[model samples]
Target: MGHPMIQLDNLDLKLSLGRLVLNVLYIKSGFFYHSMPEHRHSNGSYELHYIPSGHGRLIATGREFPLSPGSLYMTGPGIDHEQITDPSDPMFEYCIFFEALPSGRNHHERLYGRSGGDSEDIREIARLFLETPFWIGQDSRQLQHVFEKLAWEINTRSIGYRRNITIQLEQIVIGLVRNYTNNQPTLQTAPLKTLDDKRMVLIENNILYNYKHITIRTLADQLGLSVRQTERAVHKQYGMSLREKLLEARLQEAARLLDTTLLTIGEISEQVGYQSSESFTSHFKKWQGLTPSAYRTRTIVPTIQ
Candidate 1:
């Protein structure tokens, strides 16, 4: 029997990643169709599709796979795939296509080379996707929530919406990696559990409260540890040095102020605990390419326009 046909409605598109060529498609009820026929993306990019409602079938490599609600379908470079929608009740899906960068290493090197894992990691991920084409809602609601948020971001074309969509998509990718890692035997080893690390937790809370005036020595004394010990423990648990983490938190607060308040660059810098506006601007520029003023203008002015 042929796989079920899917129908979608209210299609929306967003492009991201400096617009170097990223495409996001959000299909709602009536407009559920592809303009082109079965095709292959030979330009060495990656495609990911998330099916949240209805049913469908995916035909690829001379094989047919039924697609159902909560299904995730991904095809790597040079893969040919086609989708067939349900005739009666069309499906709603979020699809994205983007170019993948080279890892500059051997297969094994690529797999374990980066913080996000590598090529072999990607292959393992593809296997998990193919194994479960239908991710029923029974799975964790967190995944569902993330997918719904992603769909919403794609559908809404607000200011910085493209950048926001890319962030959401990256979250989805990380979620998949975490989920897959949680189940794999080799990866199931107890993650340096921080939930019960009271000292680390206390230090984090203290820094959060007094981030503006925080110093390594003060934090170490409060935690009853030497400065070196405190630094080591914090780094071991969070993967970032204590100073780096504090700066990250401060920058995040600065970004929030920039987006939500009418605070000027100097005001935001002081509010976020930076003594000098120039220092704050330098730090912010390091993390985000645009300076404080430019970022705020680029991200905020579009709303008025």
Candidate 2:
């Protein structure tokens, strides 16, 4: 029989690296008892591999690296690589495929798009990965535990498992970066002022979870920021004013409800913080070019797959 393999994709897993984000596209783990064919990833894609046990050898770009227990390595875009197991001792490995790119409205741009105006920090990280296309080292971060936990979470479908998996995936990437930079000075990121990152997380969480009743003043108090400060902060991070952000959040929730539920327009309006169905319809049309009913009809119909 062929070697057993476990694979997971179609996951909405993402993690932030300052302003940029890494989106994990797939994960695979298995024991290898055979020689694998040489292959290369597409532009902007990266494959990170960790061998927790057994023996193997990896050939990357005409360079050879030994793989044994605790072996960790990364192969980035356009790098040709292959793995061969030492048959007597098959190698067991975990691998993750991901792409790092801009997030939010700027997401359409590649990590370092043609314009080349992306953050220097992002460019630096990308440069390091490209210039050193293949990295091999021993895992000093106990990342095997993380990979194990990630597999467990994915297989068990336990409560909060999605978030748990995201966290684990984030840890895996971070651990790999740490390994790469072990002897190097800490990588500089486009600064988020002291606590700014935490503050943005809080602000976003509040808007997403409490949009129904959140107001500028209440959110300001929660962040220990004055109303003006709160407004400026939201604009700075999202390129939208506080009112626009709230409107976007409410409309987004309204659209989700429309797509997934049978609730009436009035109910959705109330649930998403609209004082009246008329107001909800008006804003929905202005924001999405479709009224609630039209939007729902477009999204809720069952499609033949």
> Of the candidates shown, which would achieve the greatest lDDT relative to the real structure?
2
For model 1, state the Cα shift of residue 160 in Å: 5.8
Q: Count the backbone clashes (under 3 Å) in each candidate.
A: 11, 0
Alpha-carbon error at 33 in model 2, in Å? 1.8
Give the TM-scores of the predictions, in the order they appear.
Answer: 0.39, 0.52
CA lDDT of every candidate: 0.54, 0.70
Q: Residue by residue across 98-207, what tens digits does model 1's lDDT show? A: 33332334533433344443355455553343233222221222555666665565456688865775677666655654554454412211121222223543664555
lDDT by residue for model 2 (1-305), tens: 23235588755677665445666777889998766545544344567898888898886766667889999988765466667788899999888876655544453244455454566665555445434556778988999888888888877889999899888977887677777778353222221222243364467557656766788898899889999998887666555777876787678667667865799999999887878899899999999899999988773333211
Clashes of 2: 0
Error of 2 at 233 (Å): 39
Q: Among these predicted structures, which one has the highest TM-score?
A: 2
